[model samples]
Target: MGTSWSARIVDAPPDSAMAIEAVLNRVIAQMSNWEADSAISRFNAAPVGKWMALPADMMTVLRAGLYMARLSGGAFDPAVGRLVARWGFGPDGLTGLSAAPNHPAPWTAIEVEGDRARRTADVTLDFSGIAKGFAVDAVAMALHDLGATHFLVEIGGELRGQGVKPDLQPWWVDVEAPPGLFLPTLRIALCGLSVATSGDYRNFREVDGTRLSHSIDPKTGAPIANDVASVTVLHESAMLADAWATAIMILGQDRGMALATRQGIAACLMQRTASGGQEYMTPALAAMLE
Candidate 1:
């Protein structure tokens, strides 16, 4: 929610921009940790073991986050908000701390029932990894409801496309690569699909000359220290794509690719190697290329 969003629509209603902004605002109200009154912030401040009623939109994203956490075996955790804050990525800024108490599968402590969710432990919810993607899908749906069909919606870098451009050409986007990396540009059409990528280059902090990525490993309660430069995933749902990208990035190159292949996820991963940047595409992505 800290970044900007844009939409390229064919025959979009003049008022469509306002509608899109309204949808994004709702997501920010419910999910942005930067806002002190956001649903996520309230839930984080809620008394431990007390069930807190949350808006449907927050519930939706929470469910998706928990699902990804389970599917990735804790590689993608929504309960790492405190960890994020400790690293200066959140509202509290950096505390100059190198690490925190590691919790084993902290996401498991959260329980959801109906429109209510509660945490058994002192866990904080952070949707930084997935909320933007959900906002993209939300805006896209809002556009569709406004009778706009041909459009491409993007929040930050995650994107979703539907129908086609006025020229009847598919919405094609070049996959992002880290700067200074020499790799053949790869492009994909996001017709009725969404793509999200998690990379070490997005956000970080330099500690004693070491660049620490914003992506914290739930398993370690610290920033991810891996060779993985980035991992991109494509899904029909932007929310899922966003979560999967984070999950795969946390899993690193080998295990991430293996799990992605096993789950039949279209993913392309790049890692910084001793020689240089190396790219790997899963079978699902290879099939897409073919």
Candidate 2:
């Protein structure tokens, strides 16, 4: 996770902050693309057709990533590692050329069995879409283990919260809307759910005078050419929300809204309109506002 993280706990012990920091850093060591020795990096560096043993948690995330790829119909994929590197959003950002590869890999080529996974093809794996959310979850678990019943953990703006403050109020969070969206902010009462927001306003590059989003449409092996301003997802698991948010954003406004409705997903999608922006929300998310 190449972002800032924060943990706020009610009645947290003196050493709880340091403990939570250590826990988050440990997660980074396991999944960080920037770390050459990270478990995920090792898996990526492994030759094609070679099985790499992974930790149980990493395997769980790999399974989840595959599930999301299927659910989104390839709109969101972890196998876009090569595209990520080419678009200058990977471990070596900015210096890399921003051009799509001729033979980029797809997520379907990966094989997973128990705590081991291998690529049947020459596909590289990138976990940036979901790793931060996993780190947030880990921090929340660490806080719970430290006897913190009321806590909120956020990594790169994806967050999870449990329990109410001592004053009996829920942990309130302000979800940021992209610059062009009509609504600049949406507030939520966090009790036992995670929130993840994905947008093109941030984490993108202006490639050759064309603003290219870091989010690549695996189907085309190129940056998605959609007018979606931003999308936010709420779920019990931040990792799920994180991956889904990215997928739904790539699907564009109409398709994303339809999928969110058909699946009963609590999602908010904003589309870039001529004047400013328009938005949509699933029924569950509407209820949250009320």
**Number of backbone collisions per candidate, in order?**
0, 0
| Number of backbone clashes in candidate 1 | 0
Q: Report, for every candidate in turn, its global Cα lDDT versus the true structure.
A: 0.90, 0.83
Global Cα lDDT for candidate 1: 0.90
lDDT of 1 by residue, 24-71 (tens): 889989998989998999999999899999999899999999999888
Tens-digit per-residue lDDT, 98-145, candidate 2: 556565337988999877899887678888888887777878887888
Task: Give each model a TM-score.
Answer: 0.98, 0.94
TM-score of 2: 0.94
Name the top TM-score candidate. 1
Looking at candidate 2, the ten consecutive residues that score lowest on lDDT are 96-105
